[model samples]
Target: MAEKYCVENLAVSVLDNLRYQHDWTELQILTHSPVDDLPLPRPLISGLPPRRLYLHPDDQIEMLKSHPNPEGSIPETPVTEWVLPVHLAEKWTLKAFASVFDSMPPENSASPHRVKRVLLATVHDDSTVVYYFMHDGIVKPRQN
Candidate 1:
């Protein structure tokens, strides 16, 4: 029998891959979203990475400036991952990604300070979910 295709299943698969392979924590499945104020083909995923993923340069500078001591300052909490979950059978476009991004909160809605970037978690038939970070706008090239 052929497998059923649904966002519920897709999200579970992606979450499994994240927990088993990347060791992400505090995962959540987000629903109740509207693409351009309407429904979508699927839902999205959110979670934490094993370590910090991206830190805004402005936020980093603010942290550095606000630290009481020059040495041994406390580190900021890692931001959550806003994931656009997809299945192997699905293909996406820039427009598709944009819709998802537009629908998402700047941070986790439950915790406004949590997430700052979006991630695409593409789940394959083989149960591997490849992740790539997405930015709302063009960013400066990284030093390395």
Candidate 2:
């Protein structure tokens, strides 16, 4: 019971940071998995970032082909992302992450090529949150 409360508090802190500090919009706390209707290991956050967090290699190529001049013309569409909040001291394994990935709905139902990924929000004791992208499988590295 107490542990659950702690986890919830951590999630709220991360959400607050994302909204106030990072300027994320349309944030939501998900208690149940949208895909399977099952309770999650911990609450998750979904929100639209201020800018696109990642662009798939294929997407970049397509954009270049369409635009021809890849200067400032490429549209930056912010997509909603799933966030898994955890304390820095917590232990996590591949199976744990796989469970969370399996529970998530597609990033965009209309786009069949999008990959399954999550933003791992790890909160430190000092109330600082760090984010890392976690893909379900190996993804092609984005071109520099």
Candidate 3:
């Protein structure tokens, strides 16, 4: 149907932007939820960012404690993240987001305690894509 085509187009656009514009690697479009093998509301993009997008405050503290010079000595490994693609015009709600979160694949074993989050990639009419971080629950604000 037309709706499915539109959704696929949006997802491809977002994926292209992330791969070509943002330098993300290991990108793929996921149609089914890895958790239950059920179809997702929309396609999701999974990829590893060029750099670490977020670091938990506790993790940062631990890293500092372990490293003598925390400035550039600590290596920041980029973790694979789930990306939900949508049109800027689509209506979004908490329940909708919760469904997406509940269907997500488990996080990488390297950081089992890390919070579940997604990059909400919203594509505008003008071919621009904006990304925002959406956490499943409230996360402590990053320390400056």
Candidate 4:
């Protein structure tokens, strides 16, 4: 019988390649699966500093609203990795986005990964498109 393809295997394979290419001092593979059982074919991985992956918009809004002082405040955002399927090739839809969003926890919530932010880097043939997933709320979109 042919071996069944596992998302975790793909993520691990990619991480191995990344480690070799960057020679990162500390590389940790965060989550092997999504928090919720979404139909999308992909796994999520997150980790600590030296780089940031994603930031949810709603998270930013809540940060702004709750801060006691505007000028002097810094919100701690957690960073996570979103390991999308290698075979996937298409545009994203609302249902897909909704599902991804629903699985992530709010910034205030304590996660085993302890990531307040998430970074989703889509690896294509010779390039990558990274999307940030913030906690939950509204905020000023960063000027591109």
Candidate 3 regions off by >4 Å? 1-5, 71-73, 109-115
Best by TM-score: 2
Tens-digit per-residue lDDT, 1-144, candidate 1 = 234577788888888888888899998877755223455435777788888877666666667778888577447577677787776677667787777666676463465442346787777777777878777667665422
What C-alpha lDDT does candidate 3 achieve relative to the native structure?
Answer: 0.82
Q: Give stretches of model 1 more than 4 Å off.
A: 1-4, 34-41, 60-76, 108-116
Candidate 4 lDDT tens digits, 1-144 = 122445566556556554565333344554423344344334554434435334445555666778899777455543434433332344666566556555654433464533333444444544443334443234456522
Clashing pairs in 2: none
Ranking by TM-score: 2, 3, 1, 4
Collision count of model 2: 0
| Candidate 2 residue-wise lDDT, 1-144, digit = tens | 224238778889999999999999999899887766889777899998999998778788888879867676688888888888998888788998888776776666685444468899999888889999998888898776
**Model 2 spans > 4 angstroms off:** 1-5, 111-115
**TM-scores of the models, in the order given:** 0.69, 0.87, 0.86, 0.45
- Which has the better TM-score: candidate 1, or candidate 2? 2
Per-residue lDDT for 1-144 in model 3, tens only?
Answer: 124238888889988999999999999999997656899877899999999987767677788788877566568789887889988788788998988887777775465343378999988889988889898888787665
Q: Cα deviation in Å at residue 75, candidate 4?
A: 10
Global lDDT of each model? Answer: 0.70, 0.83, 0.82, 0.47
Model 4: CA > 4 A from native: 1-10, 13-41, 51-88, 108-117, 127-138, 142-144
> What lDDT, from 0 to 1, does candidate 1 have?
0.70
Residue 60, model 3, lDDT: 76
